[model samples]
Target: MTPFVAVVFVLLVLCSSTLVAHGGDAEAGAYMLIATSSMKPKASCSGHKVAPSNEASLNSTWAPLHLVSGPCSPAYSRGTDSSSTDDDVTSIAKMLDADQHRVAYIQKRLAGGDTSNGVAGASWDGQTTDVGTYLPASNVGVGAVSHVRPISSLNKMIGTTAAPDGTSAVRQTVIIDSGSDVPWVQCQPCPLLVCHPQRDPLFDPATSTTYSAVPCSSAACARLGPYRRGCSANVQCQFGFTYTDGATATGTYSSDDLTLGPYDVVRGFLFGCAHADRGSTFSFDVSGTLALGGGAQSFVQQTATQYGRVFSYCIPPSPSSLGFITLGVPPQRAALVPTFVSTPLLSSSSMPPTFYRVLLRAIIVAGRPLPVPPTVFSASSVIASTIVISRLPPTAYQALRAAFRSAMTMYRTAPPVSILDTCYDFTGVRSITLPSIALVFDGGATVNLDAAGILLQGCLAFAPTATDRMPGFIGNVQQRTLEVVYDVPGKAIRFRSAAC
Candidate 1:
């Protein structure tokens, strides 16, 4: 182990008791504000205009163990050299280091400033537009999602079982992020070298009997967005989505089955079957990206009617363990409703359509509120659910750090973490009092945070925003241990602290 992590582990061992029984408040009084919500998900999967060939495959095909193959591979490489290390901490830390770049790329996209789909322009490979050979993109960054998740545990949320069909599921790892739009997989004719390399095998569209291209004139093609379209003579709706980290894929739009639940088969699922790619293989390290973003092309959108357009996820703090992303209303029914406190979803054409925007009203530190301006959390509409950004905005980051430092009682002069500026001395310390961080959202919904949610090792978790002009981002760190649910169609978001 590295010296820093070693020290942290030792400190954790010594202060185990103090941390386990820390006398922090668990504000259970805020349940009613979230419980009154009557919104829930209902099954309505039949309205889709699916091709006749894809119906049987969607309803009957069962690929059990589909997630088993997507291992959180410990693949780390700085430049030309890549290391497949089994060491958990080293792999995850390296992955996070790489994440900074991807985060920057995503921030720019969320900013919605990029107009060049790189079509009458240069593509990610710096190649001129070649509709005959490959669709091109420009200013594309080199990044992939499979490189993010840890391989310690498997996908328990997705089912693994044999079906009546002759074929069984091939399990694979997935990078679960709400910032992405549309689901995609490397398909037949996918090159191992140019494709985003992941532990999982590429999705071979040719093998699936139910697969077929989405017509160029179809509504689904239009929903995929004109920015992603590339036309060829008699093109079967060629579509492409440029990942912020610079990974670009241009391919035919195709339909197939995706089993989110045991019996819940998403038939005629629309996804990009990339025949052309550029930059890095890490992006395809897993089978493909399972997009959870808020755009019309996301997995959630196509399946919204089935689940009333609602989904929730809980990303565990453990680097190795995986969390659950539940689509539609949870089986707990009304019992699950009261367990969450939520904020409203925000939207503006300026923001990325795939993002989930939140209207953050204010942040309470200890007993005092910060001087953060409303501009940091600007919203034209009440935020029911916001895009789950992977990083924070610079303005918000600076403001939060200032407020937190002022409120902290144990402001030990420790070194800073990656993006976190507010840190305290965690060495040889026991029974330190932590400040109460209450996040106030729209509709007067306030979610009080606990120590376990923020403190990482000895440092405060919030970091400086990567970009100065970047907008607000509700990162995974802030949502840690919170069961956040998004009802896209209803334009609502609900959450509450839970064991997830």
Candidate 2:
């Protein structure tokens, strides 16, 4: 296994949803932001992926994060040069060394055999560490896993009233992964034996006058699901997480004051302050991760009542373009936003709610329907996660791949990269044209894959599944530049083409 093959599956805490009934649309006055951050992309035709590096520049003060209104932001400290100090060189070198160790760990575990969580139905449980271990991108058609998907940020944003230090509004850049439920930030003076090097300064709860620990008796503590810690022991709320790629972290859970809206200050904001962490798969960009999930402790689930459980994000395919995630919108207010399609979220009794799964019906390629079963993308019977339909069992994928190969027979082929097996010959070619691909989900949610998503230079952006043993995923490459609106309370997802 290699770093190029690792994907994510997150599980964690929760809180009951409660909100005051608003007479009008609770999401009426939402903020429309053009926020963005620097990200790394592959250099043209090199067939090599440049792992995401901090580069996207926002106003540093323009609309931050996903809140409709908020002074809430994560701090982003300037990056230090590796050659500046021995310590700097040491830290970077340490991370590089850890990357090799991570490879060994994953290979050893996979060799040991199946450790899938004992969950029934179509969904496979636990983490899936396949291919080259924990990779950032997978090959589209030419096996060139060169692109870094959107949804995660290089800088982390936390809720803030004013920069306590009177600096940039950003404290750190954080990743927003919807697949996982745990929300955590790196912390300082950890009560543990080790802490990973964070690009942004760690959060020192002791210095935050408003910080307070979560007690074991609280209901909020009960919904912590898998993330709740120490209630039976020290009575201090805590949590520990280990990703499939051999990354592990542990820390305390607490409440603190944070600025949510433009001027609104919220007390008792729950989050993790991880003081101890050991992992090599991190993107090396920021404080920690902001949870955009369906669990109780997840930022989305906890704030459902206030915003009608609605949130939206728009990401441009190019790292240079603007992309941002916004949270909390009322169903009544969603009408104001135009959408190309909407689909129902599949129902699940599983814990740590499946926040991204949808009911897909079929896929039409260049006007022809591929011979595939709806069961491959439906219900709890399919051993799948988000059930994108793009992902399928090995046998099914083979069939789909064959059909695609036949459909694209007209185009001359090129060399392969990563797991991406299909490509167009560029021999002296300039611009290339691609066929249209569309995914039809329930509720008439039809997403058409445009050139940007289909053609990566001369390669057809269709990569093979790592292994049938792991749960399938809908890579962000396919979802590029799309506006995905999650209406949890409404039990549906809306999608449309957007420029921001």
Candidate 3:
């Protein structure tokens, strides 16, 4: 371990021992220290913290969600050729472009432009005017953006009758994307030119006797519907998935045993084994995406029988800190977490099935609600897992910008950075008080934003959509340090504070 980590580890041990000696809750104290140590010590603004709830103790079967740039990540790289601010700016630019592509893709799909009935190389005219490519043969999956996190998993050894051994199995790291429906990985036969460089080794099906291709006639293949890439000459089912940024992954639909978490082993888990995968949107460390959409092919729906179609995730407050995504709540629960609030999870027939929609009612700045019309936020807003920054319609955004700027006249303004127009120079400030912001959703469920969620690179983290017709989006930045739970069957989403 590095010197900094080693010191942190020793501090953790000491703190835990001291707390135990004082008859304090050692486990909770240790976790708090871990969370604090994950952040940069010299940060100008430390984020918010909330007490843990009983739900945390009850939940199990979770996997670590590590940022690709974090030290704890399997794909972490020490080559710091580029500064974090430069990377953030680049990521923001790419992410904003991808957001537009996502909205356009959804609009096209809702307008009856689905490619399920079309064959490969068929004539088509549905293309975005700004960005994105229309693969006449492929189903277009939207919302694959930058600033993503990955979950570690293992592939079961082929021809093994014995229990899954994580040590011997192939380990891979995949992005946990709720916007996309199909999970995929780079497989053997994918030349370096075809597949982008990834941290994990390519999955060679030849070595795994348990690997089997799905036949075109099977129900599993038919379930893909629009996602199918048509049957190959060998009668094997094929899939072609395209992102908003034109990244494509095309290969055979196959099945193999997968170990999702420590105690969660999924048998015959269907996924795309991509022979040809190419995308500049993904960095070198990312292997592929883990599907968490609401479709039948999504990981959530596929494992519904076992996991109850429920999952919860907490994004870390800082980039270097670690977070977690729990697949399912255990059979029992002690109680609900404090500051817990629930809002109805809305869905619309006009939208894609993969999206998770919610009704945003109003925006509150400094404990006072903005004067914008309620209709300004009437459009169904998506809970976008991949989007790094939240976006609002022009009307609501302007109102929020005005209110926020009015409240922050004390701090001197600095030049804008990329899409973040409102920035401040905190070079000499010792302590600062920021205006509190909150989002009031339908059913009066209010979610307060942490300092980290409110600002990015010393600027406001939110941007305005091109038009009011486009739906609003709740990005991951605003979700830091909070436990957000999605209960699909119950049609409700719960939120708890400071859950790590």
Candidate 4:
């Protein structure tokens, strides 16, 4: 791993203390408190705490509270094995680091302000939280391991307001992935064809003159005198083409003319080409809006121009429509602003073969007046839109998801971790294995605890069974459910649901 990866790994290992599992105590209605802190513990169990003699009391008392600060620790008392797993705590810490790094990357990208025409509030906050439940030791044989659900609730949170200068105060959530089946898609680099001014007719194959004079577009070319338009045999043409021009032409009339033949050049226009084998079946989706600041009206007007949609679209007479708007360099709302060269492609060959730039612009529009006749009230609105400039196979979705996930992993501060254990039930007839884990964050980390809470609740309420019935059994006489509780004050989130 790189140094950066090493640093992240270390940070995650430190955060894992938060995820813990309780053994026989879970069924006996026993519970524990898990606490985490940034500072070194002056004493064991100093920064945080957990409570409850049984699962019922723990749920009713600790589940809803949010934590600001304290000596955090989970309260586990059934036996030495009831404590939180070290491996789980470690995994949660890594996941948290990943989350933070992801947010940081987005914040840096948005520092210059969003020009993508999408919403600016999509920046991420580095913090995250993971909560889930696991089977008890008693359910599994004494030496057998316990099993935990593979899927847990994951949330990516960000603060959305802005500062006085129009800079956002809180980062936005640009991307969210839950290991869901629905994948993400992204555009890839396509081959580009450069188009240059057609070579002189004298250079054509039918031309008989081995040395012919051609009009020079520049002063230096004129000094070379009459010469073959595409012949290096002539000193003037050879020096001019070889030294001045970077390209060596091919065919019978080949010459070292810089202004000749197929060369790499960017045209004023851009074109897209669908695969010849795959006919055109894709469409584009575009939209625009204003990002409002203190002065709503002015903000709206300014945004409209910046987004290149201030033309016939945002004005009156015609009904308002949500559609794709071309994004310009400095992005202005004026129609045909002569700013950035932007145009849509009906087909790939409509424009030059090159990567078309993507732009995001915000604009404001007028709002309807309240009951007052003939009076106008304008409201500043942030216009955001997404366009499918090109289409790809279903595999594109998987590629996009992978890209986003990789990016997220690089940016996260705390990643999830798991621990394995074995246990037997009260009758000793049923044995089960369980894996437990936790998510930890820094002081100001803003985690989507809501999602984590829901996932924990769902797992505890639902357990897989052979009969496909509600609250079904894994084997004979064994029923399982997940029990979860989050104590924000204690800086810990815990779950202890049963698995058959």
Which numbered prediction scores highest in TM-score against the true structure?
3
Q: Name the 10 consecutive residues with the lowest summed lDDT in model 2.
A: 12-21
lDDT of 2 at 51: 23
TM-score of 4: 0.15
Candidate 4 residue 18 C-alpha distance from true site, Å: 6.1
Per-residue alpha-carbon lDDT of model 2 for 152-269, expressed as tens digits?
3223332332333332222444445565566677766754347655434456665555567787777777766655656536677777666655566667777765443222333456
Model 2, C-alpha of 416: deviation from truth (Å): 3.7
TM-scores of all models?
Answer: 0.68, 0.64, 0.77, 0.15
* TM-score for candidate 3: 0.77
- Model 4, 1-500: lDDT tens digits are 11100000000001112221223322222122212221111222221122212211100111111111111111122121222232244333333333233222323222343322212221121122221111110000000011212112111010112211222121111111110001011111111132112111111211111112222343333322321232334332221111111221111111111100011111110011111111111100000011121111112222332322121110000001000111111112123232212222111332211111111111011111112111111111111111101111123223322332332232222222211111111122122222222111122211111111111111211111112111110110011122221111222222232310
Q: lDDT: which is higher, 1 or 2?
A: 1
Model 2 Cα displacement at 296 (Å)?
1.3
| CA-lDDT, candidates in order | 0.45, 0.42, 0.56, 0.17
Count the clashes in each prediction: 44, 58, 0, 103
Off by over 4 Å in 2: 1-170, 190-193, 231-235, 330-338, 350-354, 379-390, 393-396, 406-415, 424-427, 456-458, 463-472
CA error at residue 348 for candidate 2, angstroms: 2.1
Q: lDDT (0-100) at residue 252 of candidate 2?
A: 78
Cα error, candidate 1, residue 257 (Å): 1.5
lDDT winner, 3 or 4: 3
RMSD of 3: 11.0
